[model samples]
Target: MSELKKIPADIAELSFEAALKELEQIVERLDSGQVDLDQSIEIYTRGSLLKQHCEDKLRSAQEKIDKIVNQNGTLGTEPANVE
Candidate 1:
């Protein structure tokens, strides 16, 4: 198995949608099996970073939403239901 490479610092600047789109593209490319082993490893590493970035974005958004819901208790919105 190939070792994972460090995530590029620029990846942090990408928006969640962009990262997700790139990750989806990576998945499709790997699924197609057209990529050479070396290229696949490189992309797979980057894809892992993108996946982590997307998850972090979602987690941040969820926290913000939960905070808003808590502050507006009158709305009676449950955080669990937001998901």
Candidate 2:
């Protein structure tokens, strides 16, 4: 049997390398101005998605921080003291 692994494809799941590569290509295409009007719209749509993916990845990383706690009465971010 062959081994297979499942990987995330959400914008947040993209590696820094992959996202940067795609962003570079998008910039090149936008600069060339060779795409027909119809194609330009399509490329623009793709660029929007790539941008959003990168942003979502950053947001997810930030959310994972902010030590949330539920102690003594309420739930919210509170500094954790480890001893």
Candidate 3:
């Protein structure tokens, strides 16, 4: 059986931009194929976690935007008839 490695808590706490940047770096390293098998697996796991973090951040931001739009009845700065 393979042991599951834990993702660092700090990664979850990172801003979406920061997490995406790290994920991009990981992709570059993986594409280069310079890492050993074990290192590749480890980084791949980290990249997955980072991807999830970025997605969650995006979702949260979208929810906030939706709330504001619903309250103001506008998609942008201008008011609109939602109905």
Please name the candidate that would achieve the greatest lDDT relative to the true structure.
Answer: 1
Which candidate has the top score in TM-score?
A: 1
Ordering by TM-score: 1, 3, 2
The 0-to-1 C-alpha lDDT of every candidate, in the order given, reads 0.82, 0.65, 0.79
Please, what are the lDDT tens digits per residue for candidate 3 over residues 33-63? 8999999999998998898788777877766
| Residue-level error in angstroms, candidate 1, position 83 | 5.6
* lDDT per residue (tens digit) for residues 40-60 in model 2: 887776676677676665655
List runs of model 1 lying over 4 Å from the truth.
1-7, 70-77, 80-83
- Residue-level lDDT tens digits of model 1 in 9-83: 788899989899999999999999999999999999889989888877888887777666654446443464433
Q: For candidate 3, which ten residues in a row score worst on lDDT? A: 74-83
**lDDT of model 1, residue 68:** 64
Q: Between the candidate structures 2 and 3, which one is better when assessed by TM-score?
A: 3
Error of 2 at 83 (Å): 33
**TM-score, prediction 3:** 0.75
Worst ten in a row by lDDT for model 1: 74-83
lDDT of 1: 0.82
